[model samples]
Target: MVEAAQQPKRRKRIAMVHPKFPPSFWSFGFIKEIGGFKTVMPPLGLATLAALTPDEYDVVIVDENVEDIDFEINADLIVLSSMAIQEERMFEVADEFRRRGYFVCMGGPICNVLPGRCRPHCDVLFEGEGEYTWKQFLTEWEKGEHADNYVQEEKVDLRDTPPPRIDLLQTSAYRVGCIQTTRGCPFNCEFCDIIVTYGRKVRAKPIENVIKELQAWADAGVDFVTIADDNLVGDRVYAKKMLKAVGDWNRARRYPLAFYVEMSVDAARDVEFLELIRHANVVETFLGIESPRSEQLKETKKFQNAATPLLDAVKIIQSYGVVIAAGMIVGFDNDDVGIFEDQYTFLQMAGIPIAMLGILQAIPRTPLYERIEKAGRLRSAAQGNNTLSVTNIEPLKMTYEELVTGYRNLFVRSYTLDAIGERWLNNVKQWGSKRDVPPFPGKKPEDPNPADEPNRKWIQKPLGRPRIHLIFATLLILKYYFAGGKEKRNFALKMMWGTLKLQPAAFMQTMNYLAYFIHLREYAEKVVARDEKFNYVFDDKNLTAESLGEDGHINMVKNERSKKTKINVNDAYDGAEVTADIAADLEAVQAR
Candidate 1:
């Protein structure tokens, strides 16, 4: 017999699609009108995968949140990356492509967390971190054969990672760019899945590696970037070094880049840490002050937050001219119906402008999940996007009705025009004057609890291009005020003039909050009007992944208004529904 010949190497075309993210507070969609951008940040994971792929492969990345995907694109492989919240859209897209006979490969957090639900939807599946596993798959792909599943048993070393393909992103569609400097958080917040997925040991990319990414983003016309780490200050020593390197890198540029980061509330404790952050030109810090009540902090084992008063921590970070945003939670086991009022009062008192308040969820395989399951309170799988105001676990202290009702009202109250004006005013008024302030702040007589004292580390940074900065700020205020109703215009005058008078340096943040005033309030109104009928997804007994229907869609039922069904153990219903899905069904009916 003649010797068989080896298959020739071929450069395959790959299409990477990120599913559309459902509307939530994080959508920040008002930027479309305010800044003419549709998305907040690009999908960095898919971009990183593009960089890791061999150069011979043709790659194109599409973010559904920014633009629609071309269903019929010419591609040898259809690659998808999604979070669990985006599974429905991911499934719809995956099924459509597979129907057309393309090899659909799926990966990212969606696969890692829900393998059983996802495996059947794609021809090839990848679980765990893609940095190493992705490269392994590509090698076999080049040989014309690869396994159906690729799982990474070991975590990736940050120093070995390459810069993401930022050049492949549609930079003009996003208001801010994003990069990850670290993975893994040291805290063991019971409800958190980040630690479960990435582990407790913090791993940071080398300072030089981060600089390469920063330059890539800057070169791609990205001026404001978000450090999308779960906790940037997880390792303070590495964090300080990273911040200073960024500061030096930024200083060398004619136009410096700005950043927003998520960090532990305790980062405010170290004066040196805050200085380095300001040195790096960070404009904001998102602190996970999960609850205002100490009991809830103890309940979740979030000891770091309990180490200091959270309200004072807010004040300390704010003094550096850094905006304070927060991650807040309601529906902890320690919470009661009264918890709603308490959360509202605490937010108002702390002067934090952007609080991402969510009803706490019990994520799978976490300590909280195990505890909830053991206690028979883990009702269903988590929907993953926490700020949506619905969660999987049933409340111990309040009824389901009360939980959703209170959450809806809290959303409305938190973003009201009056509340918006007060918080921003408080934000600037509390900023400590740099030179005259004493070392120990918040002291009638030298109090050391950081949040109790005003920070004395305030420094004025140069206005790089004053005309451009002033015009952007002016346009924001004018546009928002004109677009808003009578109540908003009144609040804008008070907030804009008050911020300029109290601290001209804080004017930009004040105008930015006005955009939030429109975006968040509109989101709240849409959610509140949502027929609470969708909340019935939880009331179904023995409801599992199968209950969401064979297509993984909570497909809507076309029942008369009088025939609206409440979930029951023996209902035999095969599908669940979300409010958006219900609205789509309504549109279909009207079209018919």
Candidate 2:
């Protein structure tokens, strides 16, 4: 063994790689076409980790989303950061780097929540917040300890946390910048891992610190940002103050910034909060309106959403001119196959055009995982991209095969061109015509990056975003109309006439929704096609799996569902799922 005093004094080189995300709806794959950006939101956690890294080290960030990883780059150690969705690629990179005799360190949400799976792949693993643990590791590394793991025993304090190394980012490559103003969430939804990783108690950065980060992003030419909080309204009092400060700051700027945020649906009840959001130039809000049905809502312990009539709550927020992008899920104990049509109808009525419709998943470290594991009901590991109907937990009410069929149908029915167009145009009419509509969230107003921004002249306009470069608009209109068949021309005409007739300012937003159609429809089709290999079809009109009873013609899968087995939604301790009763449900499925 080498002596500790014999270590080289030379500056260490660290290669920090942010893993590539799998194809998912949330990735906004359409950004590359219209915005010329590689991704929507940048990886905030990795960037923050780089800040925690010591000054003497030469840290180079390689975001796989913007550019491919250069394995030959100079480095003494390799650091990989990833979310649960990026775990597969994270491990592959880790194992490769280790094979080449490099010490690989892994952290971020993937490692924090699923350390067991990640531990074997990485030489050094970090769990929970890296703020304190990373510094501890750095101290030990300099002393040549070569420790295998470092974990933060206690939650981090945001006040003392250093600003992320934003200077290290290749900022221009991303369409929407991201900054986390808070850590942790208040609610305890059983299947969710947000509270699992960050915990239920919320921690927030100071207002001044947030503005400092905003100004840093502004300097880097990013004016449109997404507040990457698990739930921004987790602490209503703190959120209100931060919103006011941000709104004031944005309004004072030469070119105001636009923002998007995620919060619980109950935020609609707080008109003061909505006012703050509007003044803050927040153009969009993603609400976890997981299900339209009250039973499903209560079942997940997502009490905030269950407290309100979802459709009315969605409309209340939209009336403030902030468009709502919703999260919808299927396969609850209370859910039968009929949730497909139920959710689709609810989304249309609520005019929530953008949705991340996914199936219920038992993520690692969550209550769902423990219960399902105990019941011997887990089918496969959850890869964290729920959009493709992948889930580890077999539901208490439906067979895995039948669940997948309804899931596939939900995507097709929800994303059908006609369905999306109707919702899109209707939403534009409701909010777009009121002149209260927020500016289209995009690049900085004055100077958008030419190479990355598509149709720059049209999208960079200040305030209401009323001006569209007619020449460029004409080209896009012609390209869509004549490029394909009947649907193409109709959508093309709809894009042009819809925006122009309803609200001129809504042109960019109109184009955005149209691009979503181009992406979501094809994506849905591909996911459905991949699932077709199992050879099962369930009628979209069927109310439940039993309704297709002994039908030789309608339902291909004869998976039985049990009404007898269910865990009390209130039994969800804190934020963890308590689905011990689901064993009976799965046993019933096995019997069929």
lDDT of each: 0.72, 0.71
Q: For model 1, what is the alpha-carbon lDDT of residue 519?
A: 79
- Model 1, range 70-169, lDDT digits (tens) per residue? 8889899999998866777898999999998999999988787667778888998998888888888888877978899998768889887788998888
What lDDT is obtained when candidate 2 is compared to the true structure? 0.71
Off by over 4 Å in 2: 1-8, 432-435, 439-478, 531-592
Error of 1 at 574 (Å): 47
- Candidate 2: tens digits of C-alpha lDDT, residues 1-592: 8666876779989989998877767776743544456886787877888888878999889999888988777898888988877876787888888887888899988777778878889889988888888888888888898579988878889986777888888887887678889999988999888888888999999989999988888778776788989899998999999998987777567435778899999887798887788667777889999887777888888888777756556666776667789999998878886666667656765568888888887887888778788899876667457776556667887677677777766677777677787667656655532234553334344543222222223332322212353344435535754687888778767766876786676665666566556667767665443532222111112122222223312322222322433322233212322133432322232343
TM-score of each: 0.83, 0.83
